[model samples]
Target: MAGLFRRTMDYLYLACVVVGTTALVLISAVIPYAVFTRYVLNSAASWPEPLAILLTIVLTFIGAAAAYRLNLHMNVAYFANKLPPAGRRLLDLLVQLLMAVIALFMIIWGERLVEVTWHNTIADFPFLSVGITYLPIPIGGFCLLLFIIERIFLGLPPDPITHGSEAPSFD
Candidate 1:
């Protein structure tokens, strides 16, 4: 059962990485095109800007979940690291609990936001529903919640080695 759960989470994390990367690439391409069309061609495109904004939202939320799972999210580890091993473990558990709460809030409010905006259409793209743009919020929240649960129960994955000057190797 544990193996099955871990495998499932691994797949989900991979999916998040793929989706986040695709959104990031699309946003990068769209923004430059929007800028070029507006400034270089002297004809501003309406859809690109809004599309890029939506993609950014997707990238941010989805990427955040992946980062959290990988333990790559920004955190202040100074105080926690200074503590003894048991204390550090307790602190880590506490932090995970807090993250779970935040994820729950996102899931609840994000769905509400989607419901409220479901009937509204995007200004730039009349065919696209505004609620569709907000889908990432709840989806990402759910991903984050799953990761939090996995970490709390299964323990964290091993840390990857860093070779850069910013993260020097002690060994």
Candidate 2:
């Protein structure tokens, strides 16, 4: 059952990556086209700037979730590196819990923001709402919280190299 859950998470992370990449590409293309039209053709794409900003925000949040799944976030390990293996494990658990708490905070605050913006719409973008623009924060925080919880349940340790052990001699 645990293995199945892990596999499902892996697939979800992969899907997030694929979707975020596609959105990034589309945003890049659209923004550039808009710029070109405005400068060269004396025409403007009214929605490009707003849409590009929205796409960028969504891509960032989704990409962050993918990174969380991959355990690619940065950490301050200079002190933890000096600890023994068991100590290292404890420290990792502590950090994971802290991260989960922080994520929860973001989720709560983000939801509040969304609620406040629920009745508001973006002035520059007619089709998009403020809620849509602010939705990614809570979603990303939720993903991050889940990832950290999984790590805690799986007893994941910080990277071994985070200990700053010397590399094996090549000679």
Candidate 3:
């Protein structure tokens, strides 16, 4: 059962990486096109700016969750590293709990925001609901929640890129 769960999480993390990278690529591609159209073509496109903004939101929230799963999110290690082993473990657990609380808050409030804006459409893209753009908040929260649970129950997974090596890499 534990193996199955770990495998599932591995796949989930991969999916998050793929989706986040794709969103980032799309945002990069769209912005250049928007700039080209506005400056070279002398015609400002309405859809590009809003589309980029929406993709940015997706990239931030979703990519953040993916980063969290990989233990890549920024943390102040100076104070924590000063503690004894047990103390460091306690502090780590406390941080995980705090993160869980924040994820819960995001899920609740994000859903409410989505509900409230469901009827509203984007100004430039009338067919797209304003709420749809907010979906990343709740979705990212759920992903974070899963990662927190995995940490609490199964311990942090080994870093895929580093394996178990502690050696410094110049590359």
List residue ranges in candidate 3 displaced over 4 A: 163-171
Per-candidate local distance difference test: 0.91, 0.79, 0.90
Give the candidate number with the greatest lDDT. Answer: 1
TM-score each candidate: 0.91, 0.81, 0.93
Q: After superposition, how far is residue 90 of candidate 1 from its true place, in Å?
A: 0.8
lDDT of 2 by residue, 19-127 (tens): 6898799898998899898999898878888788888888988788777766776667899999999999998888888888889987999999989998788888756
> Which tens-of-lDDT digit does each residue in 36-124 have in candidate 1?
99999999998898899999999999999999998998888898899999999998899999999999988999999999999999888
Model 2 lDDT-worst window of ten: 155-164
- Candidate 2 lands at a TM-score of 0.81
* Sliding window of 10 residues with minimal summed lDDT for model 3: 160-169
RMSD of 1: 3.6
Query: Which candidate number would show the highest TM-score if scored against the true structure?
Result: 3
Of the pair 2 and 3, which is ahead by TM-score?
3
Ranking by TM-score: 3, 1, 2
- By lDDT: ranked, best first: 1, 3, 2
